[model samples]
Target: MTWSSMLLLAVTVERVGELWFARRNTKALLSKGGREIGKEHYSLIVALHTLWLSSLWVVAWNVRVHPIWLGVFVCLQALRFWTLATLGKRWTTRIIVVPGETLVAAGPYRFIRHPNYLVVIGEIAVFPLCLGQPLHALVFSIANALVLTVRIKTENAALSGSRHV
Candidate 1:
């Protein structure tokens, strides 16, 4: 397999690991009275992510992968790892509010309120562009941006109402 393919596989593994960790944390939080809001929006998040992954796979299989672009793709994947590591157990794919939880202000949270989303934004372009599919990048980037805009607004509002924020 090419480096790009390997990098993509590694990312998929890391994502799975992160989700496993997040699930454990989420269960603990729920046991402590954490509540999930915006169920509908969360569902939309799943759909969008599915589309993003599908597009990435399609482009990866159908287009020619370039070395420089592959290198950039790896760098972006590292950034994604950074975002996940920074968030630790607090990182989740869903909009869940743990009751009485304080806002996190350490790590990447110190520099930007939503570094995870920034990673997402970068990946939407990096992956497709690596495979010489700028059109895929452009199309999905726009869709991802729209979804993230709504997600940020809702999440920020939730944070504002919380004791944290």
Candidate 2:
């Protein structure tokens, strides 16, 4: 396999694993009376991410790895992991809020309102650029930004309604 193929495979595996983890956490949270906000947008988010990853293979199959972009991706992964670890079981890909739980204010959350989104935005843009496919990056980044605008609003409304975070 080419380096891009291998890297995409790794990312695919990581994403699938995260889905499994997030599903488990979501289930647990729901069982514990957690409320899921903005269920309508969840599938679109999934579809976008799925297509983004899928396009990486189609758009970058023969492209060589760009080391600097790879470095950026690695750093984003670190922030992603830190965000996940700090949130622990509370971290679902969906906006599932556990009632009575306060906002997380440690780790990456301490510095930014939505560190995960920033990391995701970087990944969407940077990964395509890693393959020298700036067009793909631009398209997906713009779509992601649109999706995030709605997502951020929904999440903020939910949090405000619950008086949490």
Candidate 3:
């Protein structure tokens, strides 16, 4: 495997680890009375993400990597880590709302409502571009936008109804 493939492989492994961590966090939060919204679309979201990453290897395994796009993707990972660190225990791949908890305004949250979503958007698009696949990036970006449209609305409603604003 080339250096770029190795990078992507490492990331794929990291994503699996994240899923495990998120599940653990989500379980803990739920045990503490966390109310999970958007359950209806949760499966779809999982499938989309799972397929997305898998498709990356299938489609871009041998494609020449674009260094510029990869660099942007690396920057996005920094932002992703920042957002995750800010949320700490509250962060999860799924929308699990802890009732009565105030909105987090620290870290990247201070400047934007959905900083993690921005990272998600960037990853979905940028990673494909990094592998020189514009069609993958474009198609997945549109799909992600559609999914986030529902997720954001669901999350906003839940948050607005609870203590968080």
Candidate 4:
């Protein structure tokens, strides 16, 4: 299979694993009376990521894949996985702030306040560029940036008022 196709397959598998783990985490949090905030933002995140992935597929469909770019994309994907694993039960597509929960300072959080967002920013550009679609990358990156700005601000506000983990 082509590198792009292989990347897609790997992403699909990883997302499935993430979903399974997230579900378990969600259930545990909910059982503990944890409340979720900014649910609409979660939906927006899903939509934007869907658009980004669709654009990658569209660009890859017509263009010749570059090996160097594909390699970069793979690395970005690995970063994404690492971020997710680091976050563990704390990771969610939504901005859920469990009441009284402490901030996570370990793993990727040790270096960046929002490592997952960093990975997402990289993926938005990396995948499209791998397919030689700078236009799509530009558009989607801008859109994702705007959405992330709102998300980060809200999430920080939510966490700031809470105690440290």
Candidate 5:
């Protein structure tokens, strides 16, 4: 009903669409001999993200959007798009590594090892700030950092000894 609520709804819809795309990519990669790493912590990552978004919906639905923060959020989405487009079919929500497949080194990947995670970090913080929820931003950003610690380690170990980038 509110502008913030509508924006959150749009974000949720976008997330669902991304999940669908990731699932398809996961299946394809698995069929191609890719193995998923860090399965144990995957559920926690999912729950954290789900709760973050749900909390935003509960607390920010009636809040006015901040133009500056919204602009930052839009910029983060642009980075997200670049990361996704660079990875293309290799992009998924899970840590999947196919043997002999080199890590991506194009687009944002050329600059950072985990561009998608960077985008996610920005989203978790910026989205709440856009809705004028600083506490929400702080809480979720901390939680996401903890999750990313485990995730990045797992990803690093998985990609270790692989081809360049």
Candidate 6:
């Protein structure tokens, strides 16, 4: 495998690990009476991410990695880890709000209402660019924006009645 392919493989493994962690968190949240909102659009989000990653593997396999872009991607991962760590066990792939729970106001959440989404937005674009696939970056970025439009609205509505951040 080429270097780009190896990087993609590492990313793929990281994503699978995240999915496993999210699943465990989701189960725990649901068990604690956290009801999920916007279930209908969840599959679209999953499909978009899956296709984005899969397409990169197909089109960027032979491409050379861009050092600067890879650096940006690394920074994004750091932000991602911060967001996840801030949320801790409350972090799930889906919007599941536990009633009576206050929104987390620590870490990145202190500044951005949706820090995780911001990180994802960057990733959707930067991952491709780092692999020397700018066109792929643009295409997936647009798709992700469309999906996130609906997602953010749903999330906001779900948390609207809850305690303030």
Worst lDDT 10-window in candidate 5? 102-111
Provide the RMSD of all predictions against the true structure, rounded to 1 decimal: 2.3, 1.3, 1.4, 2.0, 0.9, 0.9
Residue range 1-165, candidate 4, lDDT tens digits: 775677666666776776787788887777777777767678788888887776566557555777887788778777777888877777776666677778888777788888888888987887778778888889989999988988888888777777755
lDDT of 3 by residue, 39-65 (tens): 998887898888888898887787788
Give the Å shift of residue 136 in candidate 5: 0.6
Clashing residue pairs, backbone N/CA/C < 3 A, model 3: none
lDDT of 1 by residue, 19-114 (tens): 788788778777778876666677777777778776576557544668787788677767677877866776777777877788877777788888
Q: All models: lDDT?
A: 0.75, 0.91, 0.88, 0.77, 0.93, 0.94
In candidate 4, where is summed lDDT lowest over 10 consecutive residues?
Answer: 54-63
Q: What's the residue-level lDDT of 30 in candidate 6?
A: 94
Candidate 2 lDDT, tens digit per residue, 19-44? 99999999999999998999999888
Q: How big is the positional error of residue 26 in model 4, measured in Å on the Cα after superposition? A: 2.2
- lDDT (Cα, tens digit) per residue for candidate 6, span 32-148: 999999999999999999999998888888889999999999999999999999999999999999988998999998898999999999999999999888888899899999999
Q: What are the runs in model 1 whose C-alpha is more than 4 Å off? A: 163-165
TM-score of 3: 0.95
TM-score of 1: 0.85
The top-ranked prediction according to lDDT is 6
TM-score of each: 0.85, 0.96, 0.95, 0.86, 0.97, 0.97
Stretches of model 5 off by over 4 angstroms after superposition: none
**Which of the two, 2 or 3, has more lDDT?**
2
lDDT of 3: 0.88
Off by over 4 Å in 6: none
Per-residue lDDT value at 63 in model 4: 58
In Å, residue 91's CA in model 3 sits off its true spot by 0.4
